[model samples]
Target chain A: MNLIGLGLVGFSALLLLLFSIAKRKSPVKLRAIPALTRLYRAFGLSVEDGTRLFIALGRESLITPNAGAPLSGLGMLRHLTERTSLSDRPPIAAAGEASLALLAQDTLEAGYQAAGAGEYYQPTTGRLTGMTPFSFAAGAMPILRDESVSASVLIGHFGVEAALLADAAERENAFLVGASDDLSSQAALYASAPEALIGEELFATSAYLGATQSHTASLTVQDILRWLIILALLAGAALKLLGMI
Target chain B: MRAIAVVLAVATGLLVLIGYFIPTLAPIQSMILNWAIILSGAAALVGVFNLIWVHWGKISRREKGSLYSAILLICLIATLIFGMLLGPDDSNMRLLVNSIIVPVEATLMALLAVTLVYASIRLLRRRANLMSVVFLATALLLLIASATLPFGEIGPLNNFVRPWFQHAWALGGARGILIGVALGTLMTGLRVLFGADRPYGGK
Candidate 1:
């Protein structure tokens, strides 16, 4: 990795770990969930009322480490399924890959059974929309435009071009909880609406939203290491500038 | 099998974590990178297979979208043959594919930019709010700054704005976003490692 790139990655990881730990200790909830949850609460109207959550899983993202793995996003999918019991409506898990679709379907199915809500789950809702990003986005637009989606949680490996999907949801007045580990995605998130989840935060969604113990602990470690990296980088940069090396 | 998948996955995860600390471990790094490439390549095949299966099923069932299926299949098979058999090394074949494909893909993608501009216009007509105004203004500025040709006397402007935009957008704005991106990745990896999030048929 280039010096600055490595520095950014190293520092950011440290910061997140630190922040995650401190946040864990606090009883006071940001409720905003780093920004997007508040948007959801405002647009979605009801927290307890049955509302559909749509997750767009990107297939192409798996190729790039910077974008995180598609399977990692599937972990979030599993978490969503597990947490669906707490919500009134089961999330409509959309996948760009059939394998991911099957994984999501099985996970959600198992989760429903685990949550004792097996009867409420529908196989049709959790489906493989298409094999391509544009096709998948086309298939998903109808759900945003036609269906009553209380909150759309797009925590997966999506690309920059799919930003319009989030914009479509916003225009339709749907609460969008979008997350992707792609750099361009973060830029899109910042531009379209700041409610976007950046790199590691996309992975943390299951932990953040579900409030699971392991997720919480892992997030803490991540933040601590991230801060440590940042401090080291700043010092190194300063030393280099002063010709201390 | 499930237990094995879990064990392998956990081992892979731990190796990756440890490998991060031991920067000199090129083999570990390569293994992780290779795994990523293999898994992703496998997933792409899954996409192609599904596409073919779905199209074939549509044709058999005489579905309403069967015609679209025919077009899709023709494109898919043609592209596959062109790519695999002839290979992109053949300039003539590459030109043939690019001549048709590039324009089509570009046109479709161009629709998005059009839609964005159109939507912004509609929003401005409706809202005229501060945030909306800022959004429209920044987009316009970016578009104009990017697309306009700075010839002759305007060379200085281009030189000045290009570096400024590069640093501000690429370095500054990008840094904050990268932080969030790193956090999301670390969390997802952690989740999978802890078995709190099982992705690969793990129990």
Candidate 2:
């Protein structure tokens, strides 16, 4: 047994429980994240104006270390789908991995069902743009033109190849919000994307997009853990400096 | 149905998690992984079909990109047929991949380098915030320092500035970001394990 791994998991689970209880009494508030606020605003406008929206869920398959970013994108997609289900032209999802594409379809359907608009569900909305990273970006670039997408969120496991998609969105004059797990992609996106979520901000999509109280609780737990980890790192550095090891 | 899905998920997660801890469950873990690999391969086929279907619609409806779709379909069909007959390890299959996919992807990567430089300048123009200024300056400094002049490496830039920025500041910031990302991933996974968050069809 990896005792340290088990310990971390247990600690996190406990924090989640504590936060969940606390969440019931009062609302969980997060600091203003302009990226998300802008995205939500775009969603409202997209629906109201009957323009299309695109979400490029990047190339990483679900069963990898890079899966978390893509999964976060999926969570956001589910919520966004529900919100946009009533629109004349709902959001389109483009993914690189085949399985992720399958999951995106399922998520979209679930979202439509949740919105009580299952009849409006379109399977083509969830598309496997390409199987490879660069290919995926190339395939997804057309959504801006073909669908006349006015807003896009490039939230996924992307590499430097993400810049191409961002450039395409820019050309269309679409509101572009991007976040990725990989550092190179993040940097590239930061340069091109007007509203870029840096670092772990991408993972906060579910909570920011109003998924559930549980998501808020999870976010709170994550916030606490971040502080705890920071303290531990600083303490470790101090101890090492003192040669106390 | 949702309940069944949740039960299946929890059981699979527990089995995999516990199997990692106890050596006795290694065989079970290996078997489960094999199942996952098979499912992944099947899903890839589904993805290909989905691509074909979408493109087919484009062609049938005489959409704007119908000609591109036709070309893509033709190429895809030819490649698949050749790949099946020659097999993946065959010289012809290698030739096919090396001839087409490699050069295109490599060209895109080369294009990326130029785009990144342009993007940095564009960043400053688009957003003149503190972060943007810092980002552009650092990128410019790194570019200059990393390059070899007619004489040699820039003394302070290469020996002190670049090294300090790369080794200390960048490394520290990257590690901090990584820690946060890891924590988020762990929490998200745990949320699913606890059945508090169902990202599957159940949600």
C-alpha lDDT score of every prediction, in listed order? 0.64, 0.87
Q: What is the interface RMSD of each candidate, in Å?
A: 5.2, 1.3
Q: In candidate 2, what are the lDDT values of residues A1-245, reduced to their tens digit?
A: 47777777778888888878888889678888988998999989999999988998999987776778888888899889989999999889999999899989998998999999999998988999998888898789887777779999999899999998888888899999999989988889999888899888988998888756678888888888888887998899999999997
User: What range of 10 consecutive residues in model 2 chain A has the weakest lDDT sum?
Assistant: A1-10
lDDT of 1 by residue, B68-171 (tens): 67887898788788788878788978798579766765765777677555555666564466966775676666565666555533554456765676677657
Candidate 1 per-residue lDDT over residues A101-202, each given as its tens digit:
766666777666666777876665566666666667765666666556766766666666566777778777776766666666655554554366655666
Query: Which 10-residue window in model 1 chain B sums to the lowest lDDT?
Result: B148-157
Best by lDDT: 2
Q: How does model 2 fare in lDDT?
A: 0.87
Predicted complex 2: CAPRI docking category: medium
**Share of reference contacts found in each model:** 0.33, 0.62
